[model samples]
Target: MKKNRRRNKTKAKLTTYGEFLILLPLCHKEHQTELLEQLKSAKRPAFILGKEVPATLNTITYGQLDDFSRINQEKEDPAVKVFSILMGLSQEEVYKLNVFDVFGVINFVRSELDRINKLFASIKVAHSPEEIAAGVENLNFGTFGVIDWYAKRMGITNQDDVYSVAWIRIYTCMKNDNEKAEYEQRLNKQYVEKAKRKR
Candidate 1:
């Protein structure tokens, strides 16, 4: 009976420690300072319940803080590169973006790159004119979709800017005569619509 009780007590203490770790990341810097102080004050009593709780929690919290800073630093440069290349922004402009905005831009570019890669793969294996046409259509759709998404995300309503940033040169590399003409027509229509909106 005593052994069972001791085991259950240890389990409960571990559960509490787990909860503390989970919530630690959600705390603001100021709140985290307060939490650290509280943990220090509670450590003596916590040792009575379980010797591991307070020391383990402190070590984990400090490790998480270091990791958080390191991750943000690591992500910054790659995020800036993606923004600069895809959006045609200068490095200085990319550097001005906040961490959250940088992350959003990186995610958008990564997903769009995946989509474009898949479209290219489909185009490569196309056996007939019809299959090629279908692939071209899919590719065009994804291209324009990405441009539209970027326009919205960056608040760029200017059609010219959007076109300049578009991967049209890369997109046209594998196109046939008919597919190229079709894509040109779509772009012209989009330009016309954008001009009308400006008026």
Candidate 2:
């Protein structure tokens, strides 16, 4: 009985998605300060029950948060990068998308989509949940398990839903075809300029 009890106690240290979801509202300035103080007071490496953990909205700056809000507020049109990720389109494909088209289901509902996008940016992307490619931790949608964990906590069972939101946000910031082309052009110009200088 004692061993089982101890095991149960240890399990509690691990967090769930609902715990993380709660942090969205708590990321406010006043709430954040309080949470930070609480975390500082605790100081333990392991997660504290309902207190210290990634779900605790104590670390983000207001600017980072505001950016997240804007991202969420934007319409999820085909022109939006998130839509591309949700649809599993390549960056090249996303780059060619015109915002003019009003397609079916391309646009997300205002409020609910905002809530979902804000969470992805503020928590999953910012928190380092999953890695997209090896040695590319900072890449968008990189935190795979973290997203899953968040969904589970919030009782969001649809894996596709979670992945779609995450992918879209990450895709927005991703280097699309135009950006890649521009970069490559710049590099080529630089190389030619360097060669002329050498001569």
Candidate 3:
């Protein structure tokens, strides 16, 4: 009887479809801010619970981009919040999802975020390999920021049209804007330094 009681219980794995359904995360401003903040905050080093340990471990998952529960918003992992936004699943859906499926959901969200990070790889921001890669951290803000950037630079007043464009196109415009800004900054600094030398 004791052995039977102690037996390990088995659970079913996540179900499969023809292909995973993945879409760009919500483009709303508030959603974007929440999503970005979740990813940003997830960077804090994890610690062993109820134990003294150094909090120096830095973990970065591929290409280094980085979520759930309603039980308590304060104590819940950031991923929980992100899942609701990125997966379009409500807290109830998540609560009912299988443990294995939860991981699948988390990975799906990360992949989408990873795709966003790849955009920063070739931008004109950083010089060294490390520096360029560091843009991943800097550019993780939500889509609202990107849209605002395009509007400010391209003089786009038609809000509907702007919002309808594909996320990649919007991101490309942002990349171009960043490159241009860096170039102008470099040019101005050179002139300023030259003037100082002549003084």
Choose 2 or 3, whichever is better by TM-score. 3
lDDT of 2 by residue, 112-175 (tens): 3555557444432222233344455544443455455446655878754554343344333332
- TM-score for candidate 2: 0.19
In model 1, residue pairs whose N, Cα or C atoms come closer than 3 Å (at least 3 residues apart or on different chains), thus clashing, are none
Best by TM-score: 3
Model 1 lDDT on a 0 to 1 scale: 0.46
CA lDDT, every prediction?
0.46, 0.40, 0.46
lDDT of 1 by residue, 31-107 (tens): 55755543343312222212221221112222222222244435565544544444445556644433333444445
Local lDDT at 179 for model 2: 61
Error of 2 at 38 (Å): 47
As for candidate 3, its clashing pairs are: 67-78, 67-79, 67-80, 68-80
Cα RMSD for candidates in order:
19.5, 20.7, 15.9
Residue pairs of candidate 2 with colliding backbone atoms = 17-153, 18-153, 18-154, 82-168, 129-143, 130-142, 130-143, 130-144, 131-142
- For all predicted structures, in order, the TM-scores are 0.29, 0.19, 0.40
Model 2: residues with Cα > 4 Å off, grouped in runs: 1-80, 102-111, 115-199
**Which 10 consecutive positions of candidate 3 have the poorest summed lDDT?**
15-24
Better of 1 and 2 by lDDT: 1
